[model samples]
Target: MTEGSLPRLELWCELQCPDCRTALDDVRALRERYGDALPIVLRHFPLEKHKHAYAAAEAAEEAFVQGRGWPFVEAVLARVTELERRGPELLVEVAGELGLDAEEVELALIDGRHTLAVDADQAEGKAIGVSGTPTYVVAGQRLDGGKSQQGLRERIVALLEG
Candidate 1:
């Protein structure tokens, strides 16, 4: 790898965390600014505190299979306030809004089809000091700047310039 290149950048986040929701906007801004030059990988770290988070994570993976991972993520995060009240059903509604198969999403949520993947991601996050939402990892550096878009952009640029 060359010095002037962005190392792997991953956003360890949960769908139900308010901090993660705010960070999501920052991530989207960075993605838009860099395009493929900075692909933000989303890792599920559904804090056990948020009851609806795990199911939302599973729905995200299902959406990924249907080629709508980030959109699904954005939609759910957009409804960041309604997460606890509606639980997994909120994901179904978000899917419907995106013209995705709402029933399929609901069924996947019911069966917990993507539970293992979500769990694995959580475990991986924990292994790397990611016990919170909005943890961004860049080139082996773990950053928990939350909603600090400037900090994230600097880190990403530094990695790419390394």
Candidate 2:
């Protein structure tokens, strides 16, 4: 469970979310800025309003199985427009571009293979009063904000220094 010298930050976010999409750079930058000292754990928290969120969550899990979770997420975030228009099908297209099996992502999405994990994340978040996307949990502190790179960096620095 020991990640490294720094702390683990759990990102409770949904794919195709504008807030989450806006934060993509910040999350990427945080990784580059901290390396292994700070690791981000992506947690599914698909809001009910977005119909594609759950399927996207499953696709992300499938991507993780293929060792391409980060790329898959980035791809989805990059095309929020397509996701809003096409729903789960967007995952297939993105996976294909990444050389991951498009059918595999589709099958996972259809059969609900990763629903349990996604559901568990939702339950955990709900229990902790997570009412929105892009919630960040660091050092047992829940920061429900836009999770901007600057904000995230400030929190991490404060945690590391304190």
TM-score of each model, paired residue for residue: 0.91, 0.91
How many residue pairs clash in all the candidates, one count each?
A: 0, 0
lDDT of 1: 0.83
Candidate 1 lDDT tens digits, 41-116: 8899998889988999999999998889999998888887898899887899999889888899999988878989
Error of 2 at 25 (Å): 1.9
- Over 1-162, each residue of candidate 2 has an lDDT whose tens digit, in order, gives 453476778888899788887666767777888877777899999988998988999999999999999899989988987899998877899999999988999999889999999999999999988899888888778877674445665775676545
Off by over 4 Å in 1: 2-5, 147-150
Residue 160 lDDT in candidate 1: 53
C-alpha positional error of residue 8 in candidate 1 after TM-score superposition, expressed in Å: 1.9
**Top candidate (TM-score):** 2
In model 2, the runs with Cα more than 4 Å from the true position are 1-4, 147-152
Residue 66, candidate 2: alpha-carbon lDDT = 94
- Estimate every model's Cα lDDT from 0 to 1: 0.83, 0.85
